[model samples]
Target: MPPPSAPDCYRVPTTPSSGEFRDRGSKFVAVLRPVRSEAEALAVVEEQRLAHPKCNHHCYAYRIGPGTDRWRANDDGEPSGTAGKPILGQIDKEGLSDLIIVVSRYFGGTKLGTSGLITAYREAARLSLLETVLAERVLTSPILLEFGYALMTPVMGALSQLGLEMADQEFTERARIKLEVRQSEREATVKELKAAIAGVYLAEVHDTFVVEGLTVSLPG
Candidate 1:
């Protein structure tokens, strides 16, 4: 098989989602939320813990950033791989990042085997994700361009023609415009802008972000 395409876009929940799964009398409630960082993800988990203080366990999994390298799965008090691993598996299966899923379990006077616990947590997470409204987020990099006031007209015209938005602008001795360009289009945009106006200073990209766009559906 050919190599997979680089991930320029990803799916993320538009709002919080909740679902429940009961097996062998044990109840598992899964809550899914969009998060941009590990700190945010942990805060969500803490909120759930406070809301369900009597629960027996609070297992969770989170994935951050564009690459799959930044991720974590916590079993909490459940068996080694039964809770967190299954929950994370569902998230990965849906090809989503920048999100977290937490499964809270309430003991139902019965103990579910390792396999049963895995299935229950996985099902709960899947159900929660299914109820969520997702959006396709495109990654963008910030570009700062500075030029003399004499070149303002041509620079603005070039930016408008290229369909780029100005995030910020300043008027001093020179004109400085901040633009958010899609990562894939950064190179071409810079080249075109330079060719359109002389003495255009294209600064190095220091930050990137993902912005939500149209709604998207995940494969079942």
Candidate 2:
């Protein structure tokens, strides 16, 4: 309910790490970084700049913090807005944050028109973002829940609806479940879980980190 209180952000990758493509006479180099903050994003840009000093320009954009909604973009030395704006546009279009994309350019002695430059930068940015790994983030409190098959329906249903994560589950005399709770909602959810299960379940609190997002388990 209420969008799970805006869980802390991680990344959901939509593209590969690095890709190279030619646009007109310019050589476009795109690089993707999984970032957690604006500072980290700037640091990455600096690192890239240092590494590629000979490149004509280094343009970048980043999003970080909760919901990964905070974002910034820079075109570096290209046009006033040509490079960074396109890169930022791609990031938003892809619904990605806590991430950064940098396009390194090596001029090839030809001038592409304004529209052509925009298209090239946009394409490079888009393709770079497409080459990354992404994950959903959730704010959670660490707790363990124990239950038996009899309580499965209600307990599982509640957990799923609340976006609780099962850190571990085992079936023995009873089901030993380690569930995560959001820090803001930890006390309330845990209490509700205990009360909801009552005699059918037992819960214990554990020291842990609040992680955001749910990852799909891959099949072997």
Candidate 3:
């Protein structure tokens, strides 16, 4: 079991995957995908709706962040907890996050009792995950770096030496840069930036932000 403390990386599906289940002529289609935020998750649901326009219910569950701290589950008109909860249960059972599972049900003119509905939804979610490739998602933090335009050269030198990349750079009388440092290395990186640019270049550390890496390469 992994420790309860925040982990450096979390498990997630490597790509979108789908599976289908049928019981009593009712068809349930499930798709699992990696999603970073609620907006993305909802967009996926919309896309699924477009794909399965004939489906009756589009139930779903999703979790975000390494800790799986933010999440939502929707039955989408299924009997109260019968659909959404079971799908979410599978996600939590797999110890996965930053992903969403959406199950579309096509009513086959037969009513599945509470137990049957739960079983169908759970099995649908499980089937999609069974075909998925799990991967480790690294954690990262974003820090905003600001300095006088004159200090660009020294700052660039420091970043190049550290093998760091700057993002969202804006130039004016003062220049602003956004940096994403690995969560575990953020403090050290911040210290290094200060040491290299603070006094000599009058660099100012205006703000700091935390974020997860959208993508990180895994060593072979």
Task: Please give, for residues 1-220, the per-residue lDDT of candidate 3 as tens digits.
Answer: 3344345777888889999999999999999999988999999999999999999799999999876569999999888999999999999888888889999999898998999999999999999999888878877788776667567776787788778997568888677788877788786777566655543332343334211121112121
Best prediction by TM-score = 1
The segments of candidate 3 whose C-alpha lies over 4 angstroms from its true place after superposition are: 1-8, 67-69, 144-154, 170-177, 194-220
| TM-score (C-alpha, index-matched) for candidate 1 | 0.84
- TM-score per model over all chains: 0.84, 0.63, 0.70
Residues 1-220 of candidate 1 have per-residue lDDT tens digits of 1233356676767888999999877889999999999999999999999989989699999999778799999999888999899999998888888899999998988777888899999999999998888777788777776667766787777777777788888889766778877778776666666554533334422123211221111111
For each candidate, the alpha-carbon lDDT, in order, equals 0.80, 0.68, 0.81
Error of 3 at 99 (Å): 2.8
Q: Residue by residue across 104-162, what tens digits does model 2's lDDT show?
A: 88888888766777777888887776567666666555676655577677678767766
Task: Indicate the worst ten consecutive residues by lDDT in candidate 1.
Answer: 210-219
Query: In lDDT terms, which candidate is top?
Result: 3
Determine which window of 10 residues in candidate 2 has minimal summed lDDT.
Answer: 211-220
Superior candidate under TM-score, 2 versus 3:
3
